[model samples]
Target: MPNSKPRANSLIELHKPKRASSVALVVPLKDASRECLKRLARYECPSLPPYPKSQAAAVLVGLFVGRWGDIYVLLSRRSATLSSYAGDTALPGGRWDKTDASLEDTAASFAETARFIQIGLPIDKRRVPLLCTLPPFLARSHLIVTPVVVLVTDPTLRPILNAPEVDTLFSHPLASFLHDRAPFPLPSSSPYHDMPWGPTRVRLHSFLTGREASGTKPIAGLTASILLEVAQIGYGIAPEGFEADAPGQASRRERIAWELSRAERFVEALKREGIRYDWTKEERREREKRLGRDKSRL
Candidate 1:
């Protein structure tokens, strides 16, 4: 029989991307702290109207990239049947439990859940160091979400997913997110005027870039707020504008450029009205067609 350690190493070796100037960062568990939980607990809700309060935890899982010289975040589409935030793109995490001792414990629980869904890659838990936690974000359902940032090493630990909670998992390269062409403009009719961009995208944007949006949308709410904190820690600057074209619109540079120019003003219009969106709900619904599962647990 093959040696387990050697076999594991071999499997890891197969998926490792070639060395570049920027490599994915992995922090050791010993260096990780659960202090972010305190900030999460104390975070004040954004200016939006308040809702009932519940507590939840999520992990801002990231990988180091050689080309971008920074960490990239991992995002996933939630199953449509969940009680809340159905079919939205988000980080992996769920409600806190009474048995959990701390945010780290809650994170571990999700990691295990990821494993159960077969999305748990053999992450070197020890090497994945905890960075910091963002302030808690308030969801529409009043779920106060605590986001924990962790750096992962070991390229061999490819994601294995459970289809029920996660429809698909994708990585947003820091470079792409930081690229000038990547920002999405806010719409005018959005319900979240103070935060033109919805919370999740805003959080992802903020984590990728440090600065917050200059417009009325202040990157409020749970996901966006947490992303803002992550961006501050990582890049220290936010991208100036939305991506030039719809994510899947066209591959041509000219087309992308035209779309970006048009989107800049449209985004402003959205900001004026407090609408924050890149794609319409219809777009999200259409994408759901490609995702196989419909049911999820809260």
Candidate 2:
């Protein structure tokens, strides 16, 4: 009866992600690949060893699209002038600082994703998301590092590097690492001699990207292992370190505990050396407190 007709109903539709097209695709097989990484099952690394509490670190697993709709991962060559790991290829990340809230924050800062967006890359900024955090891996420097995975929704983004920490940036397709063959006649010596549990042998896979040669140094250490886990999810392959009909594999909690036990041994060694680490001592106190509480409750 009112002068104006009844207001039209506002339709509410459930949010459904659409697949990205070839033109200006931010990442290859966008929606499907993202969902695969998001819902990835546990990665099995039965032989992965624990790390010490004295050093904590984080690295960013930043992914984007290449010219031909292939997915590429951002990697950096560390600056030659650095005190450690100079001129080595690595993910853009560093030691966890006091200002950071978590390892995730450390990765986000190093990636500079926001700066890339502000520079006018054609992408839906809101579409970017943290896929998931992978379990901690032991670095060659005796630092325990957690890999923080992030999706970059801009194909044309160029990451800004900190000259002291990072020298240059490069990318490689993820498919190349899906299945890797052991290098011919492994090197006699590696810097990972300090690795917990007697220096386990990790398979190193080599691949070429951009203008680099196939003979380029293969990504090794924790970096290689982390990529292998991600490749497993992207390609829908079975987790590494597991054989068909193997008796059993380590659970997520068990894997974490393994690292903690190794950390305790590191603490003992540090005490013997008369070296004091504030973080390690703090963690030990906290662990003791938790154990006391558990015993009281029991």
Per-residue lDDT tens digits of candidate 1, residues 1-298?
1111111111112121321123344332110111222232233322221111123445555543322233356666667777876766567766766566655556544443443342464444434434344444544442445565555555556777777787767665433433334243233223132222321122223222222232122222344434545543454445445432222322122222222224454335345545454434433443353232322211
lDDT of all predictions, in order shown? 0.41, 0.49
Predicted structure 2, TM vs. truth: 0.57
What are the root-mean-square deviations of the candidates from the true structure over C-alphas?
18.6, 12.5
Pick out the ten consecutive residues of candidate 1 with the lowest summed lDDT. Answer: 1-10
Local accuracy of candidate 2 as per-residue lDDT tens digits, 104-182: 4554453333333212222342334444567676555656677766566644455556676666677776655553333
Error of 1 at 182 (Å): 4.1
